[model samples]
Target: MENGTMPSYFYFTLFKDFVHMRYLILILTLTVYLAILLFNVIILFVVFKERSLHEPMYIRISCLSVNDLYGSAGFFPRLMVDLLFDTNTISRTACFVQIFTIYTFAVWEYTILTLMAYDRYVAICNPLKYHKIMNSKVTALYMALASLYAVFSMGLAIFFSARLPLCGTDIARLHCSNWSVVRLSCGNSTLNNNIIGFFVSATTVFLPAFFILYTYVRILIICQKISKEFRGKALQTCIPHIISFVNYSIASFCDIALSRYDSDKFKFVALFFSVGFLVIPPFLNPLIYGLNLPEIRKNIACLFQRSKVGHFPK
Candidate 1:
């Protein structure tokens, strides 16, 4: 708790309530985690195995599945361990790693979604040029750039956070976060934590959001002028992306609100917001895309049929 000294570990004060329902909570989260893994793996296998799904849009969807797996890995494993063993302490190194993984996952989610929006725009707006513009090399470059940007932005934020001299060892939430650690700093962290943090958040979250909005508006305008059947097809393709974006935005807002406001008076609501950010997106992305997209649904059906046929008694 000293200004010049740092704590070796952070104790999550929120886990005190888990003592009574630890087993039940563990079972539920484990089930959800297993489902997340299964759903996303199915999507990835379908996309990769089916050469027809090698297009940019499906590639972006696959990236989302991979990111969901990555983000879930950062949260569920540690959470289950804490619940199972009745431990709330996390080593400083492990805490920061979790923050990086979770934060980067958030950044990648938006970036990948933004890329998907762009792919949809080009497809709907300039159908003839879609393949030319979003070729394999271009898609790879977009992903690489997004990944590097997420790393640099989140890395800078984490680096600044890791250097702060801590005044406390207790985090109020179930997990460690950059803002939570910033709040524990003994000195003013406004410049690095808030100012630069705001810039990072804007680029990773807000800017991409605005860009997606812009693309959708343009697509809408284009759709209006096109034939009704074409318009319906275009909108149908965009429906899943729009749903995913809105769902993620709400979840992200809950997390931000939970971090910025004092929610001690509403512990249940606070807990919902805290865990929902990690849980909802990974749990839903695969289902949203899988069920909505005809190709994915067809491919998945074929996969299961093949499995059934292979196992049939000859």
Candidate 2:
């Protein structure tokens, strides 16, 4: 251990263990990664280009898609390289960057979900005041606050994890996470490292999740008193949000699982769980929202039709 820095490189035993399935995993990873990119990018493009889709709810959904893309890009490129090649190791600085990007993305995933839930609540429960509550200023403020909150919360854990002198070089997981890095720190003398890491993540992740669930419950109760048609509309919107939350929860659960049960027996299982959160929601979100929301589906169909009509002879 050195005073100024930790290990120069971290070799992932998780990737190393996938000797037989490396190529298979690489193919699958590439497919899912591409899907994530294609889907989220379309959402962003459509949202920005179509003036009709520029409402607060659509804007919030766009931000979530961007967050998902950012998260997928942070991990999948590095991970795909490892899967296709033998370079299971990553530079310490690069590892830290991944840690920050991924954790911040995860934190904001929850934050954005919380805000989306609030947006839905207002749309359903206080329809007349929706615009008043979710004005341009308010929408921007929600996003800014979510980013800042994620940074302060996850940044604390990363700070604790990064400042410590790592005693080992091998991380048992596919990517560099704060917990994996913190565990390499030698002494249990301080309360700052792992303890704070867990506390920071638990609070940051769970509190937002609890809040999202609470908001949905209220939304559900309120929907019951409304007309059946309106209730169906609410379900159509909220179902995707719930599914995305579950997607994220599964990814977070994978982290805990790997830390507890990293072994040869779980290598294949680990590979599936490791990439699920990053790939699944991004890959599915656009499809979920696009297909479920009538306005988006209609806009997309019109977009394609316009493209088709433009290509024909005048």
Best by lDDT: 1
Residue pairs in candidate 1 whose N, alpha carbon or C atoms collide under 3 angstroms: none
How do all models score by TM-score?
0.96, 0.91
Worst 10 residues of 2 by lDDT: 1-10
**Candidate 2 lDDT over residue span 1-314, tens digit each:** 23434678888887656767889878988988888888888788888888888898899889989998999889999988987776888998899889899888888887888888888888888989999998989978878887887788777777667777766887777888777777677766336665776677677787788888888889989987989998998889888778878877877777667665644576667666766666667787788888888887887787778788785212
Ten contiguous residues minimizing lDDT sum, candidate 1 = 305-314
lDDT, candidate 1, equals: 0.91
TM-score of candidate 1 versus the correct structure, residues matched by position: 0.96
Q: Every model's Cα RMSD, please?
A: 2.0, 2.7
Report the lDDT of model 2 for residue 182.
71
Give lDDT: candidate 1, residue 123.
Answer: 97
On residues 1-314, what C-alpha lDDT tens digit does candidate 1 reach at each position?
33545789999877786578889989999999999999999999999999999888998999999999999999999999999999999999999999999999999999999999999999999999998999989989988998999999999999989988888888878877899988888866546688878999999999999999999999999998999999999998999999999999999998997888776677668777887879999999999999999999999988888888785212
